[model samples]
Target: MQTRMIDKQWSEKYPGVGKGPVATEPCISPEYFERERELIFRRHWLNVGRVDEIPTAGKYFVRELEVCKVSVLVVRGNDDQVRAFHNVCPHRGNTLVLNERGTCPGRFGCGFHSWAFTPEGKLAFVPDEENFFDLDKSQYGLSAINCEVWEGFIFINLAPMPKQSLREFLGGVATQLDNSPFSEMKLLKTYKVEENANWKTGLDAQNELYHLPFQHRYTIGDSFLLKDGKYCRFSNVNLYNYHSVWSCEYNPAHKPLPTEALLNRMDSALTNIRFDKRISDFDWYLIFPNMALLLFTGPSGDFFMTYNFWPLSVDRCLWEMRYHFPPAENVGQRLAQEWTIGQLRDTLMEDAFQHEKIQKGLASRACSHMVMQDEEITIRHFHEVLECEMAKV
Candidate 1:
């Protein structure tokens, strides 16, 4: 047998993360989900999008936060400030922006009564102003939400007064990942799928690498460093106060496909792109509640991706996947980027399929809790954090 220094390395490093099976009630219980929706999602800094999305003035987008039952409109005003407002007209309680996302006019006009609001969320006009009994537009601006930006990611808090600021809530996550080169990359591809599974179920599935070699065998089975030449193991792991991060080295012996070989010869393939921020070949961060930030080393340059699991119901969630990469300069580089995107896209599709089946299994109640190993410490720690947060009065 291959000699090893320590078994259960993660738990040994982080002793508070107990070694035990975690209850599945958080994944399948409707009552628990409601508590999570109020105590966890609404109170935390939920990442909505990136500042790059609204690069220019008058650009805006709308997001329907199903978990909190609110529609949010994120906009960039002419003053070059980004802001978010409730996507509802104050006049008749109608939706202010019907489109999913687009550039705003001088003012957003309500379809119901033609009430208009400026990009800054100020009420600009109301049709037949003189006909109103004593209407004051100053007091009728769009309802604003708590919005903040960190490392190019925009997060919104639904709490009337958040327990902590975005930076404070991020805790060590902010300090470790602060000043990352996220602004260097550009948006590449986006995919959204409405999965019939609890948000945590999907998030838990992606937070560990124990399933990488098994569930992703056909896609990225040998992509990570393995132990005893059979199982994957993390190169580094850090469990923060409210968030966690795990990183693993890429397998050096694995052979690339023919296409990848050709692409590498033409341009830098998905080889390591050295950066000061990268801790390993791959870094996966669970940004608490429902967002994941991933940084990957590519040959040409480094790239990043984000995963947002938005809860639709206790048993349903919307999974959003987005990729950002360095701008390709040549045709070969473009082709290589496309291949990289396709490779990851396929892998995530497999994950989406498995999430539903896992939900089904959890619904069956055959097992009340999920057994954990040293490799799956992140998932266990996540449930612990979930329980701790949900328990808050």
Candidate 2:
């Protein structure tokens, strides 16, 4: 089959820099979805699960690559190492694990042929051993895949040998995470939303702040400043990858905390804390290809939150928002943090619901392409990176 090349006129007009309206068809086309499964998800360093999920030995989690029709069993081995394996039996191809997450009893046995394997992918036992006279149990171990953990997040590359290691794939983004508070935080709460939009569409909506005023009017626009929100900006208007880092400062001049609200939430230490008058900001790190880490800091301490967008189908995505907070000893502090999380949850729901409607509108035949302006540079860069990656394959 002849691959349709990107038009020469389009390339010439954009010249040196590829800037053009991305066609809406890519979001709804089945062929593009197949290409993404092979070129993007299968070849890239995709986030599988968090290390906290498999903190102890024998702890395991199952992650499904629905597009590729594969399931992976990620386990923390007795040797204090993490490993991932094709969650299938060697005897017949039945999945070894059915549950989403659990603690394996040091060994996994397939129900079909009773083929047993150790946590480290070593074949341990086989029922009716004598019946298989020439069969070698040692050679029939569970198939293993490439897996690594970075900053407490487990990443899996489905390719037999990934072109780049996870660290190399992340590049400078990993350094930014080191300075953030993710390593020292505790899980607060997680909210999962299933949206009827392509993963890129949902991610594009979150990557830029341009739509905050119009789309997030009541939820965040009331408190967020349109022009002065961002700080510590990093922009890479490249073809294959793009990233941006910025900070949003909370408004101090708006109004002092109400007496009752302060008394209910503030601790003695927090009340006495002196904040840098100019530094009441939250830092946002968007690593292109697919991940977002948000760090919020004040004089007291900090918290980290992660947003992972997983593509389920061409027009369906599973968005996970996980929050991490500083460890709290007092009950009041914990409750106050939970209240803050509740406010964020409500705000995010408003944002995600609006994106679903946007997806429906994009699917309409009336809209052929998306128009991006200068203020939406992040969204433009995202489309450029995606098109470049797709072109390579």
Candidate 3:
């Protein structure tokens, strides 16, 4: 492949995201992290999981939001409505739903006491009701949380009164991906890594194409189209209010490995899926606070991936990665899908190795700020958004 000439398009388009050094305090200071917990994580809409996880009535899953120290119970009720509630027993404040996920019976029973609640979160039974003094079971129903479904993803807001609905918080991102064929694909694999790094550090590294050629040199260094024979350039960049989408072109002349070439020759069902929701060959969207949606136009099919960075402390975070692909119909197709997972998993492992090293450098106080580049405009814009949100009183 040859080098192509390109201009500083993103910087020119998003001038308000100044081309200045971004401070490291937000990623290093313990006090700053505490502020983020209250002002950012507690207030924004956070994605817990998808509705498919609880497909049938009475099926539920529990998500622990360590940043806010809250456990969320997401379930499908007998009415077939998806709802969320705080996973805390209203009677004695004991943690409810100890398991990660389960199929609820007619009612949920607290193992500590004999209190029981319906799948609809209504208090159904309490031992020796006559002994209580004018107790109202209706008044002690499970504490509900603001939960909403978008496309198939479930989101919960911890705010007493959310400043904006999920649709409003998503802004332009929803408009662009309105009818995306996300439900057509099935989850293929999930990977979670506990990293010794700030949550933002991992997200910032993945948000830009500047490090693709260097950090991922062995795996996907040449996968994206490059400029000046060295740097990868974005085909398009859309900066939304509190969110952003970046698209890049793939190198058409790149060669495939032996297994990949063999799978391409086979009549694999992995190639049967396709959708028209792409802005370029690849699109990466940042759903504000801590989620990322990645769309890929692969040789076999169109697939998508998601990333969630959950903060555990000032210097520790959980990085979750999930891949979704078209359902396989035969053994060959399934093998091909597994191969696709392996390729991406290897590349991401390279990224996971760098996160800890980056955190160590930031903690050393050797550098007060990080210098930005034209291609790293998304990272700069993200920091700008973070600062604006943290400035709220």
Candidate 4:
């Protein structure tokens, strides 16, 4: 159960990360969660989906963000521009765009009162035009939110104006992963789980590898084969503006499971597209607030995954992990991709099953603050960034 000696001096390595006990109140208090909703979730750039989801004009999707307490309808205008608006009917405040996603043929209609609208948020038709006076068709339309895109990912901000652009928010993480073949891969599998735990608590677990060798012992522990079948050591940690990145060293001599063997054979066949990252390293990026971009090896060099943690309340959050891969041309490649999905699902269940217990423990007030190890520097850095953003609220 020993890990190879990596740099244990996290404070010394990243002196700015600071040494402090992360208070338990932030994780279990409704008031603090409210502040987070106002400051972080509302103002910060949030990645809702990919551009490919709405490739054609008039294609739209509704994202129900419980944290922000608003349903956002993201649509592609006739000009091929993407935008977001509050998914509410202007006349009666009825929920607009009930379906999760679809193409509206450049127009949308409110089923509640038969109010029609364009993809550009313009009123196209009204059921009772003569009934209501001063019903300016131009004025009564879906209120728009600040929307932007970065590297094909659609992002939205509920704030009247976001403090920083998506590029600024991404900063170093973007530079590090700029060469990453994210666009070459498409979503292959998606796992969504709602758990009874503070969003921060679940995020803390994901932001570090401290628990991987232990908590995922049976599911992924054997796969890692770290020294005595335990311990995960990060090669390096880099903190960027409002974000962080870590590198995981893949042990070349490590033993692979049966499925991995098949994955390897299929992977070796696709030698045309070789990325250094896919060979033996995992570059994990933690975007501020609640996005994790992890690029690692799959059956091919074009594989990656994203973990999005959306807060619903002080004691609950929705966790989603999406696996992305290049289009498979052979059955072996397809099976390998499916095997990876199954493995991730099993591993996440082990993680989800413990969230409620953590929330309950924090709520009990058994401890005022929790300790952080050098190996878990990212968790500490995450709290520091969160506190800074919350201060602005």
For each candidate, give its TM-score against the true structure. Answer: 0.96, 0.85, 0.97, 0.93
Q: What lDDT does the true structure give each of the candidates?
A: 0.88, 0.70, 0.88, 0.81
lDDT of 3 by residue, 1-393 (tens): 222246777888888879889999889999999999999999999988888789999999999999999999999999999999999889999988999999998888888886998889999999998999999999999999999889888899999999999999998999998888888888889999999999999999899988988998889888888876578888888999999999888877557789877886773563456668688888999998899999988656788999999999999999999998877777777787787789889988988889889999999989999998887898888999999999996
* Per-residue alpha-carbon lDDT of candidate 1 for residues 1-393, written as tens digits (9 for 90 to 100): 121325688888999888878998888888888788789988888999999999999999999999999999999999988898999999889988999989997899999989999999999998889998889899999999999989889999999999889999898888888888888788989999999999989999999988988999899898877887688888888999889999888888667999987886777534334457778878999999899999998778888999999999988999999999887877888888888899999999999999999999999999998889987898888888888988888
Q: What lDDT score goes with residue 275 in model 2?
A: 18
Number of clashing residue pairs, candidate 1 = 1
* Superposed model 3: Cα runs more than 4 Å off: 1-5
Judging by lDDT, tell me the better candidate of 1 and 2: 1
Best by TM-score: 3
Quote model 2's TM-score: 0.85
Q: Each prediction's Cα RMSD? A: 2.3, 7.4, 1.7, 2.6
Q: What is the lDDT of residue 197 in candidate 3?
A: 95
lDDT of 2 by residue, 258-359 (tens): 642563456323432221221235656666656777766533356678888888998998888998876765666666677667767877898799779878
Error of 2 at 19 (Å): 5.0
* Local distance difference test, candidate 3: 0.88
